[model samples]
Structure formats: C-alpha cells, structure tokens
Target chain A: MLKNFADKPLVIGVTALNAIDSPGPGVAVIRALRDGFGDNIRVIGLSYESLEPGVYLHDLVDKTYQIPYPSAGAHALVDRLQYIHGIEHLDVIIPNFDAELYNFIKVSAQLRIMGIHTFLPTHEQLDARDKMNLSKFGEKYKLHVPEAITIYKADELRKAADELDYPLVVKGKYYEAFVCQTLEQAHKAFYQLSAKWGTPIIVQKFMKGTEINIAALGDGEGDCISIIPMRKLYITDKGKAWAGITIEDADLLDLARQFTKATNWRGGFELEIMRDADGKLFIMEVNPRFPAWIYLTAGAGQNQPEALVKLAMGEKVEAFSEYQVGKMFIRYAWDHITDVSEFQQLSAFGEL
Target chain B: MKLKKNIATSENGFIFNPSTGDSFSSNGIAAEILGLMKLGRSADDIKQHILNTYDVEPSQLDRDWEDWSMQLKDANLTEL
Candidate 1:
C-alpha cells in the first residue's frame, strides 16, 4: 500500500525560470515549506536558468541545480529526473510557476510510475488555469464571472462591443489585458493584441470596484485545508497587488468553495475576483498554481504552500483553515519587475 | 480638526460607524491605534503615545499612524 513519505524526505521544487523574483508564490512556498516543516523537510530548488544575484540558494534549500528547458517536452523532463535522482533520491517534486506546472502535468503519469509523488492534478485542472474555461465553469457553479466573449479575428470584436457594455476589457484567450474605451478602440485593441499575442481575443465587461483574490489548497477529497481571502489595496501596472489586506468575506469564501468543488480540484489554486458597484462578486480568473502574493497570507495564518508540500508527502493535515483578518501585504517594485513581462507573454500563448 | 464622536468596534474585528456606516477591520496594531482614536485622542497625541508604548521606531509609528488616520479620514471617520 502507498504510504505517506517518511520523515525528512527529500523535496524538490522545480521552476522553469528566474528564482529571485519576490512577491511570487514560488518564493512563498519555498519559505513556508522550510519554515513550517523545518528539519523534517529537505528542500531542493531546481530552475531552468542561473540563480539571480543576491539570492542564496543554499539558504533556501539543501541544494540547487539547473536543468535545460524541456524543448523536447517529455524526454527533456525525463533527463532532468535522471539527473535529480542521481544526486539524491527525490520523493516529491513541486512545480512552482505556471510554465513549470504545465510541464509537470505533461509528465505527471511518468513521474508516478517512478515512485515520485507530484501533487499536480490531471488536465482537468488545466481548465481552472485558462481564463476562458474558468468563466464557463463559473456559470455551471452558480458563481458570477466576468461577462466575456471570445473572438478569433480583430473585426469580430465589434460584435463584442455591440453586445457588451462600454469600457469593455480586451484580453487574450489566456492572459494579457487592455482597456477599450470605444468600439473602434476595441477593434484596434483586438488586432494589436492578436498580432502580439495570437488567437481567441476576449472582451469582458469592466468591473469597477475592489479587486480580491482567494487562494487555497485542497486534498482532492472535497476538503480544502487552507483559504486566504484578500482585497487589493494597491494594484501595479501588471495588475499585481503591490499592497493588499486580508479580508473576511464569507460570500467570497463560499464562491471559492463552490468553484473548487465543481471542478473536483485538488492541490494549490488561486481565484481572482472583483466586487461590482452593487457589491456583487465576480470571478476574474483562476490560477492553478500559487499566486506571487502567497506569503502575505502566510503571515496571516494560512500557510498554503506548507499545506501543499505536506499534502504531497501524503501527510494528514487539517481540512480547513481559519484565516486572520486585517493583515497587509506589500509587494516591492523589484518583485513586480522581475517576471511581469515574461509571465504575461507566456500567459498570452497559454504556454503558462 | 474636531474629532468624530461616533465610534464602533466588535470583538470579531468588525467596525462600523453610525455616522457614515463605513465598516472596516484592523490588525492588532491598527486595532489598538484605532481603539485609542475612539478615545478622542489627536493624531499627534496618538503618535506620541504609540511611540512611547511600543518598541517600534518613531518614523515607522508616524508613517503607520498617518496612513491609518488618512484612511479614517477617507471613510469620514474624522471630524467635520
């Protein structure tokens, strides 16, 4: 019978790119795993690129290694596994970024075959990551999501403008947002965005009010162990929260629960939401991986990253978290600059 | 500036003002500071008291107090 990992098992966190970026979910997961689990966990942070200056890999992990981006997909990842296994037998692999999550899912079955446990869900979890898919799921779950219409060609956006309200949002099928002030602006935005980002451009009704995020980790058994709901007090150029505060919104928590339950989701996830003028909440997007602001919640008593690592090790953890309200999270400029462009680009192609 | 007399706070972290009905919650420190504000203390007085009582630095206390006071003002928590 499969058993929970023995104590102090080797845990490796795999990332596809830069490691120095702060205010990222990966950084929080690393810290929480080390802080919460302590000597019981041996962390190894692996990336596809060199370590950023001023970052001490040894400080965060027992070891650090780099692997080439999986150009050949499965084969490249398998080679990385071989390399990792050679150094120290890894018991679990945690994919931190969206790109790495995609790669991890592609090779998930193979990893399980090798006695390596990965908390990654199947392709069904991919639906939650795609903005369009989550919007559809929202309807079935009775949760309100942004009114968005997807179009293929730039001219098709004219129909979106005619059908939707003014000040519509012009976004790619995956990620990337541009505001359209008029129908003509929508068309221009569609073309420019499509030319730069390719396919399924979406126009969503603009929601004016507070932006909020709900993050959680689940056991794949209809039980969520941790939930952190935050309201965006300050948003950056990339729409990342530069400053945010923990909030107690029971309705928002219910929405998150309904959405996750509808998907039968397991593992760590984040939901981007906004409250309209009437106080009605609508989901903006769903991220399958942890958000860059996970640590803000960590300090507030919901250590989701730690929960994920623990769950992956087959440990029995609490089924729910009672989060503290009134805590604040502030993201520095450097953290915002480090990965915004690249992450946005990858999001455009649905590659992340 | 005159201080507003209406003050509201709940043990569960809920705060609502009968004057504006604007609601909010605060962390331990923010809650403490706002609680003091309910006693009708001036901003400078509150700052001085917090600095003297807490191990926090003067600048940090001033900045946090200023931000908190501004938020209260935005919510119309201050006097007319």
Candidate 2:
C-alpha cells in the first residue's frame, strides 16, 4: 500500500553524514529509509567533509557525493547540488543538518524544477522555534519554555544578569552550550561561542531536572503522523545521549501533539524537554530538524523519515497508532576500515 | 608509549578499555597506528611503518604522531 513519485525507482539524498561523538541524524535517517523502503529505494549520501563515516558505509549507502558546506551559503550549495543532481537525478533530498536547513528551504522551489522533492517547514515555522524567538513562541502558544534572554554583545550579558541568577546556560546560536556559575564564566562562554557560531548568544536559566526528548513527524495539516518519547539514560561528556529508553508518557505525547497542532509543523522535529521536580515540563529547546537519536523512532514503531518521504511525494499516510514501550537504544562506535584510495577518490573527484 | 593493559582493539577500528568501560571508534590510519603501539613499537618505528604503508609525508606523520599520543593519553588508553 505504497505509492512512488515516479514509475522508476526513486533516488533520495540526505546530508550531514558526520556520525561521531556529536552524531548527525543522517546515518539514523538513512537507516530508517532502508527500513521503510527495503531494496526499492536507492540512497545517496550527501556530505560536507571527506571523512564523514557514512559515506564509506557502502552497505548502508549506495553512492556518496561531497557537497559544499553551509558556510558557503545557499547559492553555492544550490550550484553544487545541481551538478550532483545532473548525474544522480535525485527525486528527494532530505537535508539533515540544522545549519543547512535554511539553505535547503530557500532552494526548495528551484530544486523542484529539477524534480527534487523536499518536505520542509516554511521559514516562519522554522523561526517560530528559534532560540531567540522561543519566548514569544511560548507566549503565543501558551507553552512553557525556560526563561531565556539573548545578548548580541557579551557585555550585554551584564544587563540581563540581575534578572537571572547564577549558573545559567550560555548557548550559541547554532550549537554548543556551557553552564556559567559566575558572571565571569558566563562572559567566557559568551565570547568563545559567539566567535565560533556568531551573535545573539542565548543565556538561559539553568533548570535542574530530568531531560526528555520527543521526536515526532507532522502531516503539515496539523496532524501528528508519529510521536515517540525517550528519556536519556546515559550521556557522554559532550552531552549527547549515549543511551536512551522509550517511555510511556501520555502527557509528553499530548504536549507533542499540541505543539504540532499549534504550529501545524511539517516534517521531522525533536523537542528538548526538561521535567521539574513538581512534574512540570518546560520546553528547553526546539530543534527544527530530527535529532541524532532519530533511529529510535523507527526502532520503536514509526518510521518518521520513511513517512516523511511518502509525505514529500504527496502520498497520504495514516497516523502511527502506537510504539513499543521500554525499548532501549545504546549507541556504540565501530571502526569502518576502508582504504585511503576511496577517500582520495571522493576528496579529489567529489563523487564516490 | 605502550597501550594500556586490558585494552582490546577490533579490526573494525573499535577500541575498548575494559577497565573503564569506555569505547571509541577511530579512522583507518589511527587504528593502524594503534595496532602498532599495542605491539610495543617505538614511535619512530611506527611512523616509518605508517609512511611505508600509507600516503603521508614524514613531517606530517611526525606531527600526527604527537597528536595521537595526546589523544591516547587523554583517552587513558596508553602508558608512558
């Protein structure tokens, strides 16, 4: 009971192949694609660096191509992707990096001319969840979010210091966050993060509680296609969930659906949640794209990425009724032993 | 430098320190160098061996050797 965008087999491309301590969602996304399509789909691995391990996972990925980094801007990315599309004739391109989503959404119209289908949120939906605008979003939706103040200049942190107590979180625009006990530590994290990820760094009240993550997919019409809530069981020093377990929480699912209803969210998203001692849940962050732990969705019951592909193809899909409870996912690293010849081939030619 | 005791290295490039219960994955070159270190090879010997087997210059390999040593130390996978 599946339909394809075309008569011929479909070729789909995904980006952000980095799967290290700070894992990217590409590998997990690809795995979900395989689970959904089996041998019917051809997977194209789109990556920024030559050393992204996913490119060399020949079994999981059919072919690999290196694309320009997001820092090169959307036009360069569009040009590079067009070149790759000429050879690959990709039908769907699922960009898996948060930093690159704006570029992909910007070119979604242009990409459609080449028959490349992308199902993503509008720029407004993406901005509604931005860290800088999160407070406004909460006020509009009546959702609970942590108290956060964005400071453009590091010195501006002092202006907001009196309002927030010590041991707040200093977060960059795109990535990286540090907890500062003293104002000096806050200043240090502010400068260090701003220099790397640019301005409007966020200083948030550090909430102490259990961290929960919910990865869900929306049908673009305010209907949630799937929802799975997982609590972090173990975390690496980098703050990535090393291991997690699915839990049965009706409140979390209700909140996730309410979020989708409020925004009419389209495509995949992950919500970073903090549950206080009083059983109050505060939305800490809203990642516009799928989290690195997305494979758990497929593992639990719903293949959100697969469902996303179908929706992108303009196909109707039923909402996932349920998922397994108490299911666990433990991430482990493995050495992918491949010759330097393959690396040389891709680095020099931009294709493999 | 020598690899820590109870260290296990897999051909898949997985390194596990049984004592610490920590696991790590490495690239091909790093894994090869680690295998050499596990056999009690000197830094110079390992560098020469890598230079012969891989397409890296001696100067660059020397720098990478130092970096890998630091990584090993940081991971607590080696004894000096």
Candidate 3:
C-alpha cells in the first residue's frame, strides 16, 4: 500500500455478468462506473460462469475472477472472495445478482475488516420486498400492489387458482412467470416452474396494462438520490427490455421517494410497475439491486452507481435533481471471437 | 441423431435456425458438438472424439452427452 498519496485508485468488484436473454446488471453497472470514473478506477469482474463476456472485455473489466456459485453456500463464497481480495484488494464490491446479494450482505462486516465497503439495504429492508412479503410491504407503506400469494405446494396452486381469476400469473419465487387462463395451464406452469426455480411460487393477479419500470437509488437515511422511469418500447420473449425510453413523471418519482422513505432503503433498486387502464401504478416487484437497464441512468445524467460508490466510501453525495428525458436505449448482441484455447483455459483453470 | 438443416451457425457460437426462425447461442463445447453434428458425425463418433480430446472420464462424458443431447432435442436442433 502506498503511504502518502493524495488520491489512490479505487478498485471495485462487481458481479452479475450474465447479460443474455435474462440480463443481469453488472455490465450496465460497470458501464456506469466507467462513465463516471474512467481510468481512475479498476473494475474487478466477479463471475459465476466462465463465459460471462464481461470477464473478457479488457477495456471494461480490469481484472476478472470466477467465484463460487451462490448455491455453493456462504463458506465457499467467502473463501474465494478472500483469495481474490488478497490479490486485487478491492475497495468496494457491488453485487448485482439477486441470488448473490444475500451472501454479500452476510459477509459485509468481514469485508469491512479488509477495508472493503458496500452500501446496501438492511436485511429487514430486503426481507420487506420479498415475494411472500410484497403485499405486507405495500400495505404497510400505503402502496398499491396486485393481489398475490405464494404457494408452498402444488395443491396450494390449485387453491390460489380458484381465488385469483383466470389468466392470473403463476410465478416462481425468484424468476420465471406464466399467465394461466385455465386450470390445466395453471397446473402445468406451476409444476414446471417449481421444478426449475423451486417451490413457494407466487400466484398473482395478472393485470392487463402497460408495464413501466423505475430505477432509483436511495441513501440509508430516508433520501432518494435519483429516479429514472422508463417504458419498454420493445420486449423480447424473455420479458427483457430490448428498447426503452426514459420518461419524466413526478408521480413515479414520488412513489420511489415514498417507498425509500418508508423502507429507509440503501443502494440501487428497480421497481417493476404495472400501470392499469386508469393510469394507476401498482408495484409488481421490487428488485433489491440495480436493473439491467441501469446504464440508462448514466446516459440520462445521474450516474447512480457512481453515487453509490461515493456513498459506500462514506463520502456525502447530494441527490441528483435534473435529468434529460426522452433518452433511449436499444440493446443489441455483439459477438467476440476468441480462440478455442481461451475457452479451454477458462473452463479448465477457472480464470480467463 | 442429426442436426437440423438450414441452421446457420457461426464460429462465435451464434446459432440461427432459419426454418423455425429461432436463434440461440452455444458455449464453446456445445458449438463444437453442433459443428461436428452439422458435418454428419454420429453420436458415438463424436463421443469417442470428445473422450480423446478432453480429460473427462467416459461415465461423466456419457452423462454430459445425454444431458446435452436432451437440451439439443428440446431446442429442436437435433432429430433422433
């Protein structure tokens, strides 16, 4: 470590590099960080799979390390992280995967001992937005949420199906959803998704309406740093936004601020919203981390991830007051051809 | 088993089936298997070749082959 430096470079670790059909926010977050700090920061890419392209993007990620999958449990994760920290000496880690956030939060204190910082919502704040607790959260915070219930068993789905009208959504606890208009479709989707993502699937009232999304950042002290709302212009089969345009809506901003104030939420969050025919916004799901569309925040003016870094560093950052609306983002696939030996190396050695 | 005809596959592992108009991406090994399948290699031949080329044991390779074949069947890229 350098003794007397006016400004030492910041080394930040980021996860969630899977940007395929079901996108993750790591690429977007890294882009936002690059936009903010440029050459002043070194990005340490943390990946679960060997093929996450972010690991190979030399311009974006300064270094990459393959970490144990979250299913490997906390001990293995911490060991790998400890080894990586010994080498890279990260100043902060921004975990972008929903499955991995809990593990990061658990080890945050250990990380702090190593001089690494992370700004994240408390465990209670995270629990409040869970699929099982969505209704409770909305009820407690005076927000509108569609009727939903988590089914612990397949038989429970039948009961939920009887209550929620036909064409209701059968959703896994974490990911995957299907709209079932009949008992047969409901049962099939329930069984299939349960096999994939596990039990306790959510049976939600499927509202026929426009889907809107808000990506916002909240300080731990009941203050929202930035809020950017977008409406999907084009959606793929995976339900991801291929093209979206930012919109200026005070009501949406107010909802974000109110929610953050209610939960005292810290860090980046994306609120999945459904707007009905009457223009009423209902919160569908509250993602605890930044959304895959988070890069749009950087383009619009407020680099939320950069602000999050400052907050994590214990530096005070003022809330962003202005943004350029109507800015659009259209996602595309770009292919990078590497040698077969490169693939062999990464798969065999666990690093690129 | 045979790979679907008119399936456009690139070296970078992007696969586009012109018939079904469905596109998918494969990993390096999957791409190699698909390429070999496109060349009309039999499953046993490909399995033997992989066994010789990679360090995986036969039983593990067999299991992986079965799973990969199932995935290819699900994707409608293979006809058995």
Q: Which ten residues in a row have the lowest lDDT in candidate 3 chain A?
A: A1-10
What TM-score against the true fold does each predicted structure earn?
A: 0.74, 0.80, 0.79
lDDT of 3 by residue, A1-352 (tens): 3212137678999998887777889999999999998888889989888888787777888878889988888888888988988988888899998878888888888888988899998888889999889998899888999999888777777788778888899888788888888888988999998898888889999987777889999998899999988888788886788988777667888999999999999999999988887779999999999999999999999999999998898888999998877678999888877678866776887766
Write down the lDDT that model 2 would get: 0.88
Q: Write out fnat for all predictions, comma-separated.
A: 0.00, 0.00, 0.00
DockQ of 3: 0.01
Where is the poorest 10-residue window by lDDT in model 1 chain A? A343-352
Name the lDDT of candidate 1.
0.69
Of the two candidates 1 and 3, the one with more favorable TM-score, higher being better, is: 3
Q: Give a tens-digit lDDT track for model 1, residues A1-352.
A: 3444465465655452243333345556677666676766667656554433212345565655565565557678877786776666777787766545667788877877776778876686675547666567776777788888878877677778888879999987544687879888887878777886678787888888778888877678766677888877777676777777777767877877776677767888888888876778888888787777777667888777777766776778886657667777776534323455544433353222
**Tens digits of per-residue lDDT for model 2 on A1-352?**
3344356667999987899889999999999899888887889999888999999998889999888888899899889889989988898999888889999999999998878899998899999999999988999999999889999987788877778887799999998899888889989999899999999899998999888899999888899999989888898877789998887778899999999999999999999999887778899999988899999999998889999998888888999998877667999999989999999999999888
lDDT of each: 0.69, 0.88, 0.86
Span of 10 residues, lowest total lDDT, candidate 2 chain A: A1-10
Task: Write the residue-wise lDDT of candidate 1 on B1-80 in tens digits.
Answer: 33366556755556755422246776777677666667777778878887788899987776866777677777766775
Instruction: Point out the higher-scoring one by lDDT: 1 or 2.
Output: 2
